[model samples]
Target: MKTNILSLTAIMVVSLQGFSSALETDAPETITSMGQIAEIAHATQEFFWQLVPPMDDPLYIHPDGIVRAVDWKKFKNKDFTSQMTAEMKTVSSSMYPVYRLTVIETRTGELLWHNSLDQLVWQTPAPLDYNPYFFAFEHWNVDSTEALDTQNLLWGRSSNVGAEILLLPEAFMESYEEDVALEAEAAALAAPMAMMLLSPPTVTNLMLAIGVESNEVEVGVYFPSGYTNPVDVFVCSSLMDWDWSLFTNVSSVGISEFTWIDETATNSSSHFWVAA
Candidate 1:
């Protein structure tokens, strides 16, 4: 829920002179100077408070898929290696599962996007106890250079917040029809049903906060004082009804890109998964 430190609204569109270049001359230190880059067989990691290619960064990028990461300002100096015990490492790696999204327009039958496969090599878990704000060192970044491609999207873990993805939203969004009769017909039949569904549900008081600075919006989780081992929280969101032209096969597995084979259907159905 924190800004990379769990924000998703940072997504924006930008001009790319080259499909393979990044304006990282000033990537958040946690990603460049302050963060350590580890070479894994499959994944390369990026640690940052905010990334421009996806964030509305003046440093020059709105890359495509910018999700969240820990706030580097707090964890820039943290020793991630020292925070792990065998049990935590096992839970973080084997127990946690990375879940990618399969976005198909429920009504139009169009496949907006999907990450066919995903993998994570747990580098460091959030220092929830001490950082207090769920700050941690570098999370995960795809090592593949193809990530820079306008055709692909990137995903990362926010500071103890949750998994996030970054990408420039694509075209399918222009679905507005000017048929006034159609709109009137739909609206006429929905007023009564909507009123009945407005009943309130019960729940405990849970606090949430969102801060927007330099065009970056960050959402964070807060627990009541004295609360220990807070209950698990889950959230999932996406840009629906827009951009079906974006391909999200992040792991470079099986097929490098998405190709729709069925010509009869107006859209497609894709397979996506994540390895936590």
Candidate 2:
């Protein structure tokens, strides 16, 4: 009877492992550059179906249920732009899913801030419901014609760390919250607190070396004296009960002009870069 039970347990374990493997999407050979990343974004055919707004000729209700008139001819058979767009892209490997966050200045086409996540998904079969991070890049100058600063809050599941933990060193932790002062003027300044989770060893290690606490859910990360206010500080994940009104303490001085874009969700479509 003992032998029979042991055999059954071993079989079940193998079956579960196989099932997990089946769920993984293999990573492409390379996904390391902006153009490559953009190609992946373009490859997502479903998103481009909207195309240019129909020419004014026919009448149709938009997906929003608004009545509209347009020429369907202008839209029909319209080829998708082979060129890359400044949008986020997602791809996965056998072990983990990767995310590419990109920011570009529309007027100058200057790449301001770009970051990628390749191995951060510590848990097997990466979490499916990661929330979108709030990015405020290029908010440095009022006209956005000068230098740029980036603040990206990435959220993902990690087997080695707890979710919503700040992982900054002890000294940094004490002053972390003071650096990021939310501007009151940006009426839409409110963002979801759930997006601040950080769990990479590299980020935590640097924080520890700089003298901050290792692993605790953090409200924000503060920069030392030399860095400028607003642009200098970056907020990590915050608690659910955090006070939104506290943003009034500091002002962005009208430098808060940026947008937050969510990365593309995963789909079965083959994710590969197509040259422009």
Candidate 3:
């Protein structure tokens, strides 16, 4: 009886060990792939583009047809989180440091979105950090059709912190509307229409302080940089029907400054002026 009991105990112990070995053989993997990280980065960009309104939306427009300044916020949430198995962004470290990104809208100059990922174990070696990058903007084409600057992908890095970035709007103007406002103001002042006299305003070669109407186009003449003398101006219109001779309100605000409305040059697309 004693022998039989010992034999049964031994069999039970062997059975339990075998079952544990089977479980170990069927264990699930915990590692992630580099491709998976890239995919997540891609998805993050698409997700971000959906949050903001288009560039031409009236919210961004000012009364003067320039873009207004506004703050950026996520559509549904103030903050967001994502998980990615990214590779090491740094060259020396084999350890992949997950990055936190603060995305700014270049058009509005607002911090619109932010996201970060926590590190994960990998089965296969992952290459390159898969952080999100997004870029968006409006395209101004000579024609009415929409344009795209698809040459480069959106990316940013601090090198020190290993942070990356994403741009939104898919297209960007060379300058923001606010930037345009400042540029237009400066251009109008420097233009020939703003000249007060044909000579330097001051011995220090001061900039002329004459008034410049934003609506009028100033003809450009090749004069010395400090010279402010007025030069003859000529105008052109893209519209074949525009008649410059019919304008009767030719007027001057300064000694040689002159401005006239080419009534037929109604749209910006049709009006162009230069020195005669």
Q: Which stretches of candidate 1 lie over 4 Å from their true place?
A: 1-160, 163-169, 176-188, 193-276
Model 2: CA > 4 A from native: 1-24, 49-100, 103-113, 116-276
User: What is candidate 2's lDDT per residue for 205-248, written digit by digit as tens?
Assistant: 21111111222222223233343344321221222222112211
Q: Rate the local accuracy (lDDT) of all candidates.
A: 0.24, 0.21, 0.27
Give all candidate RMSDs, comma-separated.
Answer: 24.0, 25.9, 29.7
Q: Compute the lDDT of residue 200 as modeled in candidate 3.
A: 24
Window of ten residues with lowest summed lDDT in model 1: 167-176
Tell how far residue 53 is off in model 2, in angstroms.
8.8
Ranking the candidates on lDDT from highest down gives 3, 1, 2
Going through the candidates in the order shown, the clash numbers are 22, 14, 15
lDDT of 3 by residue, 1-276 (tens): 011111111000111011111101111221133332333333444433322222222111001111112112322222222332222332122232323333222222222323433232112222344222223232122221123332211212111111133221111222332334454567557764433222223333322211223444322222334445434443444323323332232223233434333344334443433332
Better of 1 and 2 by TM-score: 1
| Superposed model 3: Cα runs more than 4 Å off | 1-230, 239-256
